[model samples]
Target: MTRYHPFLVFLHWLLALMIIGGLIMGGNVLAETPNDDPFKLVALRMHMAMGILILALMVIRLVVRLVTTKPPHADIGNARVNKLGTAAHWLFYVVVIAMCASGLAIANMAGLPAIVFGGSGAPLPSDFSAFPPRMAHGALATVLTLLILGHVGAGLWHQFVTKDGLFGRMWFGKRS
Candidate 1:
């Protein structure tokens, strides 16, 4: 089995960590932070910044994927499963980019005070439901979360049941 390029593996894990951490932090801020708390604004801004970073890194990942060669994927003999895997991979890219775009839209539509990096707070437009993008942002977030779970489940299936070692392709370590 051909191993993934080291740089691609690095970006994969880095983005994964950021996305996971950002989601946890964002959820905490949303559920626990008081509206009057100054930290809430900072947390929200940082979440937005992380989304932007994810977007930038995702674009670079796609570009790198195109320019570099990937190891040939072995078919698991189930045509449906193969197709689903391919679809899921593409959907991962689409959902991530959509999430970032929708997040920006939500921020732009919000009418709350937001603090950007290295800048003071500014009042944003606050009615999220009044803006279509804000609604989409919420919906997309749910979709992204579900897709991530499905992706992980599938990887586990390949690793344990199928015993194909497919998960190791994206995992860190020396290439065999």
Candidate 2:
């Protein structure tokens, strides 16, 4: 098949938009809002919900990818670069899952479920920096951002430079 299964394509684009939105909301909106702000709770609830959804969808995507037939890997005439592409594709799964895990750890550690979701009157912690997973979550966010940029750059290269139609492989089209 030259193209991905329709469901996979759907998940690809859906997850792409969601991951980007989650990153922006977490990094900008949530970051700028002080923990004491009442709106901070609202933002946290949204961000947390999005993160969880992303995680669940990723699991479904992984399963679909494993059981479905896909187009052969693209070749750019460089073995090293080709291997790098393969590794990066797999890394997306790893990094995203890790990011979700760290986010969940932070939530549990900080009692976010009670404060943000349970409507508990307890105040949010003065700072989340005290949670060890907070550090990992921040680091994973940076890594996820970089990986996304690289993935986009590689896709553009395939489409505009190599002219190999690699971009279409992950897009919607007839399987063969």
- Which is the leading candidate under TM-score? 2
Name model 2 segments beyond 4 Å from true.
none
- Give each model a TM-score: 0.86, 0.98
Best by lDDT: 2
The residue pairs in collision within model 2 are none
lDDT of 1 by residue, 89-112 (tens): 889899889988888876665643
Pairs with steric clashes in candidate 1: 110-124, 110-125, 110-126, 111-124, 111-125, 111-126
Report, for all candidates in order, the number of backbone clashes: 6, 0
Candidate 1 vs. true structure, TM-score: 0.86
How many angstroms is residue 170 displaced in model 1 relative to the true structure, after the best TM-score fit?
1.1
